[model samples]
Target: MLTPQWLDALRARITLSAVVGRSVRLQKAGREFRACCPFHDEKSPSFYINDAKGFYHCFGCQAHGDAIRWLTDHQGLAFMDAVKELAAEAGMELPAPDPRAAKSAERRASLSDVTEAAQRWFEDNLSAPIGTNAREYLAKRGISDASARAFGFGFAPDQRQTLKAALPFDEALLAEAGMRIAPEDGGEPYDRFRGRLMLPIHDARGRVIAFGGRTLAKDAGGAKYLNSPDTPLFDKGRTLYNLHRAAPAARKAGRIVVVEGYMDVIALAQAGLAEAVAPMGTALTEHQLELLWRQADCPILCFDGDAAGQRAAMKAIERALPILKPGLSLGIVRLPAGLDPDDLVRERGAAALEALLSRPQPLAEALWEFERDAGPISTPEAKAGLKARLLDHVGTIGHPDIRALYRRELLERFSALAFPPRYARVFGREARRGEQARTSAPAVIDRLQQLAKGGARDGFGLAVLSGLARHPGEISRHEEALIHLARAEPALGPAIDALLALSETLDSPAPSPISGAIGLPALPDRNLYAFLIEGNSPDLVREDLAEAVSLLVEKPALKAAKAAATARFDRDPEGSMAEQGRLRAREMALDERIKRLGRKRAASPRDDSSRSPSPGAMTAQATD
Candidate 1:
């Protein structure tokens, strides 16, 4: 559990606008802002923002939430993790977690300790007698002694008990680190990567999370390359080897060079090309792509020029096309035949590899590779097939303008083949529709209302309501009318109470005089008085009282009325008369009208029975 102070600090750090702005193109609309929903493919913008309330709602998908909820759901972070991320973004330090959360923190710390211990043990073993063959193999591969130490290169002895006796660790702990192999005979555990040159894999934060090892001998009996098993600290799909070292170089170079193996990264770094990373014997995942995107505008994937490497590059391109923004690029660096990055660096030297990096193939050239090997487009059938394939590739590209330009280029390329005009028209229409959907305002408002009504029941509801309070301008008058209904009925009482509680938690001293900020609208004073007059359920009445108190605390006019009411209650403590009697009489008349409305509701054919009394009637009766 996060402490109140921590939660407050997180709130101050993150806002809905900042979260939405990163992925979507947001434009100001009145007091709020609007953008297309990134969670779903939308052409028209159905996502809305109320900066004042710090809330966002998507009309199309019915997604609604505050900043924290948005980050948790959109970015796939845990709730507290989202809080911490926002807190960090705001440059604020969070307080210690609650007592219950301390146990989780302790467990995490222990895992870190275990990982650090394993890394140290591996580093120490690099120069041990058992690592002689590994050292010889590295020397043969042109890896210097200094480079080996710099990368924590090491060896796992073939003996089963060597690792067990080397550290005060159990088999379970080794297994947890993905470094132990279980015996068939229930014997002692053995090393997972024997007779191999080890490469410690660290995460983005430079923690030794996992390992990758290369076979030093031809008859090592194990696979050529073995990676650490999936553990709490490592997910092969998500972790790129050498990202810790490559990130700064990638940022400095304004491009990342992705390779295929531990040696590829090590060899590149040794060759003075340090901005290279590779997956741990797996295809690139979106998580890894996001990490790369954060570091640079363009990433050059350097794969071997073999068929398998080409296929892998195509797959990576497909995975990235949808998420790649306008300025962001994905270029391919196809190495010479029968050569990986390491072999290329060793054979041709760093200057040759640097030349290859300089002449990267653009994203369009990679996409064109699909058409290069296809059948001739002179025939009608071939033309149709080519057009269809081209449209499919173009459609996968996320940006509308880019997709259209590619489509035009495809048509020009196939002009001699004589493809149907309908194909081009259809693709163009789809791109147009996507653009239209991203800019529409009414669609955003409709989605916001739908989200506000239905989304309030989920775990993210309070956050959504808080966002609404922060950004009321994104919400339309019609939507507000619907929200107003929540205050009049018992079914909506809990939701109202939840919103009020969330608001109370947000109240703090204004941070250094707000600049050009719109505040949330004042809650209706008459609504509160009406709820108190009517004999509603206790829960409903209590919520009404709370909401009234909150509003009065903020509004000067309402505060004075509240003081007068309190004075009347205090002055007529014994008499049970005075302004209280007048208020009760007004309450009785309002109750009669409510009963009449109830009878009318029972006779009406409408489905909704939660309508409130007419405002004019309530106001008239209050005056009487």
Candidate 2:
């Protein structure tokens, strides 16, 4: 009862060569491994293992299968046993046995039988005299006879009970397979499709699971394109049409193309672009996107250029952001206006589509452009809205590194857009500011030294300063926050200012004498928090530091909000009290977070100066 996705994951983890090489010695044959066929009697090697495709094949005996198949066929294990062995090897936990799910699987198998029978019957009808109109419709769409046959094109006759009468399956099974629809008032079932050119939708194993039909009659008073309802055998959201065929072609072509419909997939295939697939008449789903990623790192989405298509691409972008990994993403190709893959190939030829596919707009660029041009941005409010929209999209991204990068990049773009730079003037002004900050750093450091020597420091404030000193690179990253911190606690102003000025002057991230100059002890003394302790993970420390700074920034903002609510209490007592309550809850949460961060302090510094300088001493030591 294991799901296809789970089985696919197990196979993806287990290498075919590694499994086959256990039984037969395999030699490196370019990108694949080759060895003598274990399935047949042969002297020369004909068996080949392609780890890239996750399958092995033999030319001698024509025996072919994947890792699970290899275990079953060659190793003499049962199907479930083979899956269990591979799952154990792959460190995957087998799904607990569910009787209901088993029943569902059995039901789907029977429904698949119904769909398969219906497919054959439809194909026969297409070849018969009744299928002449469907054949002519294919011709007009530039679909060849061979391409139609390869795609298993068929037709449902313009009759109500044709499919039910032709197939030997029971009426209930036919209705369950979506080949027939049962009457609501409990009468006999009728054919679900009538007078439509049929294209069978398949599972990943190329088993006919459902059907999509396009009307052949021009004057038919019904929807032009209709897909089968979600049956036990078909979950349209999780299924991509033609993926079974397109996956192998995608590996060879190094890319996969996604179009709008099955017809577009066929047209692309006929145009020599066999590595194309389409969703089941819906926007791309998360499962389908993962299926595409399995074949290619960044499958190009070749959607049409009309408004609906553009919205589809945007929908895909929104869907993809939360699940995107380091290398796994989608590329987008927007076809010319008023043209789809089918029309484009028919009119301009396949090379036109190829040229467009060769250089697809990156997903990021597509997102930016779609949002940027979504509406007018002439006013300040409009521009701010655009920035907010971009940030909203960036915030959905799950990976922390990718989210930060996208935030930085999108905000930088927003800055460039909102306040277009005058490069020479701005550069000169920045250079002067940097030079002034540099010249004044020593004086500021001296002031910090005097203050640090005399004061009974606040422990949290000291930790924050020491944290910045230990990680000077973080100074620039949290510059604005530090400035706000300096404002909120004027006692730490000089030290924070000195760190800010020094951040501009330091050329490298190497430890400096800031800690010593600022009247703190050497590197070992600065381990006030676990984040600053030596041997801590760099990423963890950065995260902890970011949280600490964010809390520090939030403290003053919360205080100000509470003050405003108090001030308004005289005029709007009830509303202001509610606001006050909300702010008080936030203040408590902020305090709890600060306490949690403070609890990350280590026992004490280990007197390990040989390791590196403390935050206070970014460079070599300096005397007061």
Candidate 3:
């Protein structure tokens, strides 16, 4: 665990702008640097980096945090991954891991030793007299000795048990390193690879953790390429080859390209495209995609033009969709049929490969192309199928704004392609209904606000609405509770709906349209809502409003529990009594929380209003 002091020291050492500016284009904006928010879609810049404060905040998406948070959220790094990356950048050693983690760390260190020792063993075999065929294979592939050694290329001898004898490890250790196979009988373990060219797979820190081997022997029944199975230290699905080398170049180039195999990555590097990486033999996993996203927003995926390559690209697209965020997506490059990245570079030169990469297709466009060609769309059934496929892909995107836009773009193409204008006109009324719902949303909100003044329950419900209105940004934090409340009290449903709608557009600190929810009828005494809407310190009011909403949610939950406990009184007397006691204790705790919050409010200078919201405001609701 990183203590607060260590985190603070790390943050203080690393310039927030420097870290953020690598990925986002920042412009000077008075004291803070600004960029269009990476977390959401926006025309103008609303993401700000404050070097003075050592943090960044996206006013557009309400994504606010320090450097570590940026790494986790923006880079999709695991918490520890973010911390270690930052610590390394700041030149700080992490605090020692606790006992259990220390054990795991020691185990990994041992596994790494075995892999590294095996790497040396393979390199030795490469230059030995027996490695003549492997050297020939590299030469045939146009790989120079310099490039081969730079990538730590090696050869595994054809004889079995060769690695087992050379490496300083027992059979069990060798098997654990994925370097040896255990025989089914009560027999010895043998080397997994024979007559294969070897590539060392390194972790982000450039430590060898696994190996990928390709056949040097022709058409032997074995697979073309074999990777180390997942071991204590290596997971092919989570690992990317050449990342340790490509990351620095990727940061400089502001781009990263992902290819199908490690050979493709090495070929690109050899051809002067140093920013390419590839997943181990498996298709790109979410973990590997996150690794790619950390280096570039739109890494170009260069796949072969064959059926398998198209299938791989689509598979990657499906994997990427749900994790796609604004400003974070993929670009795709399809090599000509019967060609891969290596083939293209070899035949046409690096310039041709670069030219192909330059005009790569956007993921959305690729999606359209793939589905449009899935089948004939001349018939209505085929057209509907096309639309369904497009929507299915779009639905997988998790970000709200990005998802909406992808849907809009793809549906527009679908409408044009599948329906054309004549057929579109036939379904004009259906389309019109969608437009009407959108156009009428504001009127619905206005109507509901008017009705919010109709009854006592609504009056109280409107108080919750008003609180949310004053702190539009807090709507996201309390959205789940507000949604739950909507189900319980139908009177506040429309107001809750309006609050949510407004939250989506509350990208700026500009006056919220939903704040007009503060328009209240005259009451006998100024309640919490009245004071907060017109508070002197907007910050203070937002705090009080959050507490109020928490109470609003807790009240309904407590009532539901009480109802259940009372229902059980007849049959399960002792259980009901005990449950009732526990519920009462919880109610007392809730009362205390409200009192503490109210006291905090009371200590603050009051806004120019008739009264302040009571600290015990939740007590009345708890009993009722």
Candidate 4:
């Protein structure tokens, strides 16, 4: 026997991608790995491996499962064989079989028999002459005959001992299976469900584990929908209606539609959307969400357009926040006002329902909209309340990266709402100024002259830094190279650091009030280059600036190579000195290139496209 804890430990120790990749050729696809689904043939890669989530799914064929399931399905290994192989690979020992556990397992297996027997009996009753009202109710609800049979629709007669007398199973087994209600006062035990249109709820393996019933009588006094009690065979929280059927279709469709009830699921299925499921007459549980994620990355939650539906959506959002991962979240579809999925599909047809399903609101944006419209933000106090509520939701997120991103995105939305005019004015002017300055030779000259004056030895370095500070937006393109230069050459570290700092404050390469606040190196002696004068091409200056950064970035690497040569002299003196000479000459050649930068501006063709800095031409970065 293997305990669940030990199985989990074994699974935790195995990397799913490492196991899957042994047989499939995987390519890096963002946070997950993708490959052609080995289970089925396809041209484009639709299969994905997410090691973080520890599963593989094929959007094409709907083949999905964990490592153990993979071995069983793909390789045709038996359950324990797969488990034993995985455990051995994970360096885990199997647990010894326990008599109590075996007995409990046997009891659960026998209870399944009871549920299965009850399911057949109910189906027989629905087909019998006495089940006319249940059949009429199903037809009125637009449930087709095919759907009734496919979903195993049945009827429980309006009598206590109808099932008790029908099935040969003992009363204890019936009570244990939740098919019969045992009396607490030593009275006769009766059927749990009576006079209802019954639908069997299945486990993930498609076993009939429990029943959910809708009363057929017009004046029925109880709840409209009633579910079986928690029993050994079924835990409502862990079971989703139509999961076994929906899981496969969800994979093929690449999305799962979560409706409110099993009837809605059946209706959607009849309308050709077979990938729909529902919770067991309760708010979505964490276990149900996990099951949904196993079939699809982001299951679209389609709630009704009424108030209770919105509340259900909000509750689901709250439930999902703490467990959200990088690629796993929810998509919300708020149907047309005053309509549920079944209503929309029936009134507007399947196409209308499909349109809504096609365009789902992402969870984050939906969260923002839901909270923003929760109340009017007409006053400062009201706006502050909205902000507080949003932050409160954001705080509940567990993943650090996702939490920080949510905070940033939500706050940015908040800032836009609270102070839109100021940002618009500031960014609008910055854009206009940036356009004007890109071609303004005088403005370019003014920016160059702001840096500290330096001699010829420091002229090129100073020019590059000044040009970078002026085009502060491009700092990120060369951020890596700049950081490398800073680390390799300590003497230039302060000026480089200052320019990097300046780039952060300026939103664009425009003359910014904040840009003037950062310290900058003085201009090189103006006589160092004729290109520094007014009327010189700003375009050419930018090109030369990019080239200068590239040249200066190479210097440290050359120095490090020469030092490495020197370090090796004791062992390979001849080769080391020769290598050193080549490196030194390369350094001189680099120096000549630095001197030729200004001349390149003079002799270079005036191609407008070439003048614009290309990505690899300089490793300059963009704005944060």
Candidate 5:
């Protein structure tokens, strides 16, 4: 894990607008940088990056966070990978690994050297006198020398001592690199790649880390394809084949095509589809999916059109659904029933495979297509099972918006298909339509009315939210403060989320005073909200909401602290007394902070107040 101090330094050292702008094509928009929202397909620009705040938010998708999150979410990098990448860009060395991890890290470097050396040796053999068989095989497959070199294709000679004579490393180190297989009894280790065609597998940085070998000779072995054993440097489950090369192409092409094997990726590349990548002779792994995502939010999975390929696609889908987010997803393409990428490209041409990729089904549709027709739906029990399975898959999604959308869409489809409506004149259409209208209308209205009361049984912490909804513009400015408040006051979670969603949708250019048109999740205390925003100037609302958010954040925080201190009183009186003293001081200081903001409101522009919490600066209540 990256240290907080290092994270802070990284954030501070880089200008977010510049970093995001390089990829997003941002143009200066007022105080922030703006881009046409990349997370969602939109015409007008709604994405903004606030370098001062060290965060970017997509008003379209509600994607908000700092640099680390951008890398993890938008770029599809793992947390540590993102950190290391950002650190490198900032010219900062990562903090030292734990002592226990240091040796593994050091050993991995030695293994990488072995893989690199072996890669060269294999490449040399592909062109050497002993490589005639390999050369002939490539020629027969229509692979040019340039193409083979581009993919780092190589060959392992039939003789076992070829590596023994060529590699400088000893048997022990070679075994660690997955280059040699040691005998169970006390025998010398033998070459692992004898009589095979070799393809070097690279990490995201394009460093050779592993090898995938296809047997060349007759009666050659245990499996058709074998990958390097999972060693310290190579874990097939965590690495994608050709990612180091395909990532840039994926970014430019706006999608990655994930095939089933290294040769498929090579064939696609040969056919001018440079964006294709593959798994290392196994099912696609979660990490590989993430790697694809780093290049494009929605990657295309091109599976061979066979029962095995369908199973592989399903496995990848099941592994990926849990991490599905609002703006990131997958697309699927099943090749013609019995052919793979290489076969398709070879038989018809690049255009034929390109045509298949051009028409990709959404993951939801793919999931529905697979599960819906798996068994008969004529029986209600089977239909119910389909619905249950769909719900289960949707439930795994982590993002609230995507989860909700998937559920709604899937359920609606199930309801229509499992229990289709009757003719309009008969009764079903009119009756069901009326029922749905009544069911939905009262639901949202009654909930809002109850929330506005702050008195009914269904009260939803409405007071803080009504004021927030009336001044959604303030939500972004006070997000951190609100996040802290949300933690201390769980009851306000729904309201906070609603306000955030509404605020993100609000337009820039300094919003007008709250109107009835401001969509809110729940109604506020009507009289208070009306008095606060009706005919109020944008500046006045900013001042008022500034104070409101301050109070909302501080009051709840202080109250929680007091309650906590009181609880600890029975156990640790002295500590509780000290805590109580600190809370009281913070409470008073919070009052002072509010007073200072009030004074600043009268004297300065709205920008001064709207600038999000400055570096190392916090409201007194937050300090507590």
Candidate 6:
């Protein structure tokens, strides 16, 4: 655990001014500095940085936090990890981890060691006989040896345990890194990537977290390309290959060229078009999209002109619509027919690929492809169906003005299609329906508020009710939202109770049970709850014994009840059947309640009391 003095020192070291100045142009506003918020799309500056307070607050998005919090949220670092990063930036050494944190740190270190070992083994093999074919194949593909080493290309030997002999890492650790197989018969570990070309996957911070391997042989058994499974350090869905090296170049070019494979990214970079990344075989996920969005203003998705590639590009566009805004754009760079990015760069030279990237189609042009490819709308029914699909796509756009313009464009396009005048009415009707849907959402919010104030039987339920009542329209019925809230406020049992009541009252079924809802409290109530439960609880509660005690004991004051039961059981030794039964019931009830409370405490998070009121809070107070 970080001491208060250490936290204060760390806060003083990396102020909000430093963070904002690096990303945004700031103007002095009395004691605070103001700039356009980096967290969202904004024209006028609404982000305020208070250097004296070591925090930042954006009036536009209601994003307010200290330096560490800002780094964690904006840069996507884990809380303690963010703290350490900031501390390192500030030239401060981190204190030794406590027992619990020590174990976690050790596990992370083990994973890191495994990855580093695998990376070194691959690097060594790249020059050896085992990697000769892979190296020659790269040369044939026009990848220079210098470029190959720069991007850390290597080859995994066909033989098993090739890496095991080279590194001091244990088999279990290698298996965790997605490098070796865990044996059932206590046999020696075997390589996971046999007879494949290796491309080391690095995090945004440039640490080798995992690897992506491609089959050398056309008839290779398993997958054509294999990516590392989710481990302690790498999540394939959240990672973009070559992002670490490409980020600076992408930012400089004001665009990121997203390709489909490891070779596409490497070949582009080698060809001197450095701003390129590839999805790890999966469709462009929202997580990957957000990562790219953070690096540059616009991201150009360059895929092959083949049917599969077009389908992938469209999927990417659909995934990005909600996230992409005015300054942030998504354009498509269509390669020549039947040619992938790697093939184009290899044959036509890097200049041709770079020219295509430089002259990407506008977002509207790419979005229009969705309609163009769907076939013509000659009849009224066809036009109506088209308009509905277009409207759904427009609705997904986050910007209202952008959505409205697209709606108008859809109407204009339909008019051009020579559809009857009645077809234009379909666009108007769909726009009205979208408006109505937004208006109807408040009704759900109002219902949740009513449930919260109704004082449900469960105290935990009432607490949850109170929270939902506080943010009526903002909350969602999705399990993710609940889980997010639970993580923000560990002591959200009461709030969750209210949510449960709201769910029940609305005749909606509760979804799957999420145990860690209270893990990292996001709300003020949740944060308070976590502080109380984790920081203030006795050793029993801290040890997760509270749940067992709650189930065994009865009533609200579980500690007192447990004490009474224990005394009765001790005095009688061979107690009466009725007395023993009563004692057992009390004990069980207490255990259940403790568990419930523990879960609740984990869900609700408290706001940092050390910081002053944010701009929004001050304005709210003034209004009140």
TM-scores of all candidate predictions against the true structure: 0.52, 0.63, 0.60, 0.62, 0.59, 0.56
Candidate 4, which segments miss by more than 4 Å at Cα?
1-68, 71-96, 422-624
lDDT of 4 by residue, 1-624 (tens): 577888888888999998888767899999999998876568999999999888999998898999998766554344786797798889887786688877897899999999999899889999999899999988888888988999999999999888988889898999999998888999988999999999999876578999999998788889889999999879998888998787656655678899998878988999999889999888998888887887778999998999899889989999999999999999999988899998988899999999988999999999999999888899999998988998899999999558756765687578558643212266455334343333333333344344344232456666676556545555555655677787987656766666555544444433433232133334534223323322344555455555677687777788899999999999999999999999989989998987676665556454544443332333223222
Q: Which candidate is the best by lDDT?
A: 2
Model 4 RMSD in Å is 13.4
What's the lDDT for residue 223 in model 1?
A: 86
Q: In terms of TM-score, which candidate is strongest?
A: 2
User: Which stretches of candidate 3 lie above 4 Å from their native place?
Assistant: 7-94, 421-624
TM-score of predicted model 5? 0.59
Candidate 5 colliding pairs? 75-294
Q: Candidate 2, which segments miss by more than 4 Å at Cα?
A: 1-66, 69-102, 186-188, 422-624
Q: Pick out the ten consecutive residues of candidate 1 with the lowest summed lDDT.
A: 507-516
Give residue 483's error in model 5 in angstroms.
33
Better of 1 and 6 by TM-score: 6
* C-alpha RMSD between model 2 and the true structure: 11.9
lDDT of 3 by residue, 293-362 (tens): 8888898999888889998999999999999988899999988998999999999999999998998899
Task: Give the clashing residue pairs of candidate 3, or none.
Answer: 598-615
Candidate 1's residue-wise lDDT over 452-504, tens digit each?
A: 45643432222233233332221221132224444443344454443333222
After superposition, the stretches of candidate 1 with alpha carbons farther than 4 Å from their true spots are: 1-105, 183-188, 374-383, 414-624
Weakest 10 consecutive residues of candidate 4 by summed lDDT: 615-624
Cα RMSD (Å) per model? 23.5, 11.9, 13.8, 13.4, 14.3, 19.6
Shift of residue 204 alpha carbon in model 5, Å: 1.5
Q: Rank the candidates by TM-score, best first.
A: 2, 4, 3, 5, 6, 1
